[model samples]
Target: MTAMIKAHEIQGVIALENSFNRVGLDHVVLVKVATAGVVTRLMGGSREEVINALSNAWIDGQSLRTYRHAPNTGSRKSWAAGDATSRGVRLALIALKGEMGYPSALTARTWGFYDVLFRGNEFKFQRPYGSYVMENILFKISFPAEFHAQTAVECALQLHPRVKDRLEQIEKIEITTQESAIRIIDKKGPLYNPADRDHCIQYMTAIGLIFGELTAAHYEDSVAADPRIDVLRDKMTCIENPQYSRDYLDPSKRSISNAIQIFFKDGTSTERVEVEYPIGHRRRRKEGIPLLVKKFETNLARRFPAKQQKAVLDVFLDNRKLVGIPVNEFVDMFVI
Candidate 1:
């Protein structure tokens, strides 16, 4: 668990900057790099072997951001991280088997990753690897929407009761959000699939306002076929709040803030609803953990028998007991 946490820290810290995204590369490349480094170390690889595995990861081709953006968004964005992590493990094992690696895979002048993919700019870091990322990780406790749109969904849900019965009376909806949300999820036009819908702030907020809930199923075609969703979506105008954007990148705050207001055709408006820190934020950990545990139990109930659920929960719900169990033994608890 510590090793995995460290891996997450490595990836998350590097991802604090817009490094990979600025280069049009998907951040899952960090998953490959971080996983290779940590998993190689876990398998007892020597320093040289770890270095070789890391080099292999860097040399591995990265996925483009296209699959995560409009016009090409699809389920590939969902599985890209899994694919990258699998490749990471494969490279680590190969390196352990004595496969050679390029020493300059990232800096080999003309053909290196930096030159070829990053526009010749070196990767930047906000801080050294540590527990910061793990300590401050955000959970998607309430909605299956994109992280950038999490607070937006929350804001919409807050206003749901006021606007649910007056959908047609809404003349316009204004979404005030951070720059990151604007850059990534302020999508317009038709959303082709669940993947696209989940990434769109307007679509997510619409579902929250109309249904007073946002779930993974809300993004499906059946629910999306409702014309009111598009009606709300079309009425939405996303505007970036500079302060919100600044606070988002501020390490001290790291807020994902959003506000939503509805204007009625009769010239009246609902009070603007704003959410600064989402339920998943570290600041809201006290409120988030119980919900997270409930989500876990609900998911477990879907596949496991009562006895199996209890057995799994017995270990996971107790921190000391969970920590004492060997990784393989812990994994075996879930094996059928």
Candidate 2:
């Protein structure tokens, strides 16, 4: 535990993100699981948590949603972190109860988390649990954008002021992102929806640069159709993260840092800027948690009442109270 960065910590994140990227898992789901798992451990969990969580959790069985489609991503992200915490909790509980895990979990499914998500691989231990995950979770600080695209968004934000007067002067917008950007966000042609548009590195970077602001609405069809977006995506390029990948997977490090550069028709290009972790990461916890809480508050208020929201927030703020609260109660609060 001293040497290893808990899968949920920033260090763990660094390792998992790079390794999973090889197989196609985004840092988001892994981050969720890592946070939830490590947190669960903090709450004194065991293996039963993982199994029971796995049992109740559904695998969509749809090829479009399966790992084989991308060999890296899937829908499990929605609940996987919760699943992970539950798994951790279950494992802890199982150990407490003196029950045994199905030995097959380590080898059974055509491949476990390894074979299924990892390309017939095994977990390579670079270290053990520590404050690493919290220390390195990338912060979505500048833009509430995805981790991989945040730097690109930041670059666009900078260009927004300069390009505002030259929207027409820009013959083409050129930008570069890490290789993960190309695989996960780079796109061409008409982006039909916000989901599609936001994922397009070109669309995301261009809009941020042009508008100086990016929100969930920025990715919508109306915004995506703004002609300028496609013009920019047309100029975008993304490449693999050799060092980022190296540092990303090094058990002692975890980051979603990305570099972004822009060019104008006149041939002058802005300096490339790189950012490693999202503001929401643990390293920035001292500064970012309050902001994350704000985000959580904003999001919670959107779907829940003030009183209910208060209760939920209060519980989350209190570690002892939160861990003791029934899972059903937590589920009930989230359910409409």
Superposed by TM-score, candidate 1 places the C-alpha of residue 103 at a distance from the truth, in angstroms, of 2.2
Candidate 1 vs. truth: CA RMSD? 1.0
Q: Which pairs of residues collide in model 1?
A: none
Model 2 RMSD vs true structure: 6.1
For 15-97, candidate 1 gives per-residue lDDT tens digits of 89746876789999999999998899999999999999999898888889998889888999989999999999999999899
How accurate locally is residue 66 in candidate 2, as Cα lDDT from 0 to 100?
Answer: 38
Q: Could you list the CA RMSD of all candidates, in the order they appear?
A: 1.0, 6.1
lDDT of each: 0.91, 0.59
TM-score (C-alpha, index-matched) for candidate 2 = 0.66
* Model 2: per-residue Cα lDDT over 1-336, one tens digit each: 331355545435346434555554543444434443344455555556544333222121211223222333333544655554454454444444544344454345774454566566656654455564555556565565656677667667766777777765565554544555666666666655555555566777788877888887886667766877666667666666677766654555555566766666787766676667556665567878788778888888999888999989998899898778877797887876
Off by over 4 Å in 2: 1-120, 129-131, 138-144, 171-176, 239-241, 251-253, 307-336
Q: Name the best candidate (by TM-score).
A: 1
